[model samples]
Target: MKIRVTGAFLFNVLCTISYTCCGETVGKRPPHIVMIIADDMGSNDLSYRGLDQITTANLDAMGFNGIIFNRHYTEPICTPSRAALLTGQYPIRLGLQGEPISAGEDRHLPPDVQTLPQLLKELGYTTHLVGKWHLGTARREDIPKGRGFDTHYGYWNGYIGYFDYETKSAMTITSEVYEGFDMKENFVDAWKDKGIYATHIFTEKALDIIDAQNKDIPMFLMVGHLAVHTGKNGMVEVADEKTMNNTYGYIADLERRRYVDALMNLDDSVGRIVEKLQQRDLLQNSVVIFMSDNGAQIRGIFHNGGSNYPLRGEKFSHHDGGIKNAALLYSPLLEKKNYIHDHLIHITDWLPTLYSLAGGNITSLKKTDGVDQWLSISQNKPSKRKNILINIDEVKLYSGVIGYGGRYKLLNGTIQSGFYDSFTGEPQSSNKMDYDIAAILNSRVNKAIKKSKVPGKHLDEALIRNLRKSSSAIRNNSKCNRGTEKYEICHHFCLFDLWTDPCETENLIRQKSKDDIVLNLKNQLAEFWNEVSPQTNKPVDINSDPAKYNGTWCTWLDDEFCIKIKTNNQNKNCNENNRSTSSIPVLKL
Candidate 1:
């Protein structure tokens, strides 16, 4: 026997030896990560998702080229969802699940929590955050740069004017666009009257960041776009007249027209970012995640013209439309593409998932509500997360939780009766519900074991039986215990099988053989709540006291700019006297 090593073979051998010696395969580099979050975008907002009125060519292409998550869920509002994504914990745990953080409020996301950027930074990745940072800006320590980002740009308020970037409160009003390398020392206002659109400015800076970053180290850029969200002072503006005129071409209704224009501009931003990545020859080596903080604000009195069609309820509710969001993951690194993965995913999960993709160990991280689903996502394998606690709206005392052990799902507290295909955005027939659920669950589990390198079997016969029985118990044991109220029989819960009824239109509370399921779920809810800490909403001192605004952007609290600005006047249409009188539903969890 003779062995011969050619020049090419020796080169390959040397490369392999170098990798084993230094953990690098010749010139290979880590993938860059970009996360683009759209504000107040709904499930059906994009044309690709069946919105007849809106055109989102770029987002549509993202979904078509990457993977679309048809059933991803988030909190019913922005601040909570962002906190969950950043901290990898439910908002309830961080005392951020209530109303959004107002401009002058002293409350903020706890600085001690380990954020996604902080983890990435520890992994030698440079991180930048552009656009809305609603979690909190009441203090310097609570801002993005303080929370692990290397560079921070954009507003610190809940929402700001598209052009002015000003946010108003009862006491003061100030434009809140600033940029800095460090929040504690170098923070300074970046845009006040730049004449550039918010969406466009954010994108321009994002491209600049990409261009300026060191290519040798991986980068994580989070563009938290303030598109399609109505401004705090009731302002609704979009691209300039010329841009609107040339692009959208005369949308009839004023509010709706501006909305479409805003959405279109957002699409343009995404297109520009992708184009920049392609131009830099980084498209194939980058992973871009596009998602909404929550579903679209479709039913507010001053509607933003965003749609969550085919799914019941809107923002601030417990239905699919409110919690379920439009989401997509794009990357050439993915084993599969151009497909929809119908798995249960929570906003908190992104921290662990993205961290794992960046080569971090999931088990070594602090405890969080999120489960690392990198394999399930990139490989199109079965999800390790089979269940999710949708939301616990303390205001309404309503909670929606999913138990995906078997085909059965508990809505408020009962079992679901029908089927709704989240992938197709359509309801299914009740007759084929059981068979369909079992088949899909089985196939995904088998594929995960055979093809994916991850370990976990979320669906098994024994687990399904136990989960089903528990859900039935909860429903049956629920009794009428009204305190200082009318003595009436109320189930206090609603049930739906997400596999069969993703729309959550049909309630199975009236169905038989569901007592055990309800009781178990109720018990589980109690346990989950045990981990949720209470929120402390520190009051904003908007009075003419300069001392009160020391740490916050509320220095303008005494300023009457809210009355002086013409844009504020233009927003009078959404004022208290002229606002829509349409009623928003208080969802039954």
Candidate 2:
């Protein structure tokens, strides 16, 4: 006997089954998320990226076993990139596209903006932040605790001394330089941990959070490391004497050696975090993301002896060296692993992508400029993003602007008069030893196979190694017509095919066939400029001086509020005695 069912009836039956399965899946716990951000790290800083001087064994292992983001982009500075990461929106929309939020500046991420931690908390996950919180501190409501995290264990300023934990700030109001301790633990001064190195301290705190997390409840932890960034007085803080003396003696440049020491310490932190997750039996259900905030400051303010060699421009320019960052994602959830993702990815995409991965409805994220790239990343699908508005800050010194669409990139104006638009770093031949790519690949691949859930599956180590080498070759390949000429400031406009000339060595403005591409990019920039909000930067408030608060950077405005209220009450009493109630001023509070 043959039976035929109506199409509508069959479809209704399938829909009912799908709904039932979805309901059951929603009751299960989501994956744990651990995001680690490095400060002022360079594109070529990692050994896997062809920097022969430094050895990042742990980072290389993660890259080899996970997905290496070859074309990831971030803001050219600290605060903007961070803001974009947490809010899933362009910094221009949030008034955070200007300079970083300096010490005592009355600038911060807008209070009404929904942050990543806040969203994660709503999804029944515990959230913690354990590093730099350069977002804002003008009000008690601007710190990480107020923003969404359950706890914060780090500094509130941009950068601080590695050991002393002191931040030096030049007051915009008084023009006096003030230095004070800046470490904090959940809104209180963390004075006891002053002598400890920041990388070690932050790592310990992250591990503690992971260990204490409830297995039934998912966790979200963000480790914002202060390593690789310049410390007090613009110096790269090195590790202890014994470790430095035992290793990194091959490099003659003292500054570069110090940077390598700091970087290795950061790598150790990564390895420890992964090992801890494995020991806790959380490795199978955890997703780890590692990224740098922006490119290194090689030759400008806060120069850290870091390098973004082979890519033009440094920390503040609108070039690849400034915005193209080092990033990778590792997780058991990925269907495809041990490959490079060359698609365009912006920092803003993290919020929405992670939210979707946590089983949240994408429609809930309102007015977000970021596209959900979870499927693109996990399943190896094409990226949904077509164009990226890098940045347009009219308030900055150089009025720098950049717009990227398709294979074409358009730039207008420049940063620091394009002084950093040249390759700058320690020479590639500084070290006599060559990097052993095969050995690193083989080690990582074997470890990954041991931990694999699939039975009898093997990774082609040679193919993976070739993938890494080819990706590096493509990134460093430069086909430019101009030889030995600096990429000068683009006072008006400049156009280049980034696909062919990643170095920005050739200007294609005069080519008639490319006129349409230039016009389209300019239009995109104009559209972005139309929607930009006024920059939120404010002059440094002298009242924020730590001298008034026992040599610690506290929420000074909170104390100021109490003082103002007391004075207002006194004035009100005096006015009442004089029979002039209307003279009493009403405080806004």
In order, what lDDT does every prediction score? 0.63, 0.77
Stretches of candidate 1 off by over 4 Å are 1-27, 171-186, 191-193, 233-235, 242-251, 405-491, 543-589
lDDT of 1 by residue, 158-202 (tens): 776665455654433443333111111115544232335678779
CA lDDT, candidate 2, residue 72: 89
Q: Per-residue lDDT of 1-589 in model 2, one digit per residue for the tens?
A: 8786543343334334322111223223477899999999988888777677765777877776778898888998999999999999999999999989988788899999999998878766789999999999878899999999999999998998887778988877568887777888888777667667889889999999989987766789999999999888678786575677568877777777788899988988988787677767776777899999999888877888788877777888778889889998878767787788888888998998888777566786876888888777876777888788788887753433344434777888776667766666444434556666555545533354346453333445575566568557755464532356566557668887778888777778889998888888878888888899989888888878766666667787787532222254664563344233223222110
Q: Could you tell me how far off, in angstroms, the CA of residue 505 lies in candidate 2 after the best superposition?
A: 0.6
By how many angstroms RMSD does model 2 differ from the true structure? Answer: 10.2
Off by over 4 Å in 2: 1-28, 397-406, 425-430, 437-464, 475-485, 560-589
Enumerate residue pairs that collide in model 2.
none
What are the TM-scores, per candidate, against the unseen true structure? 0.73, 0.87
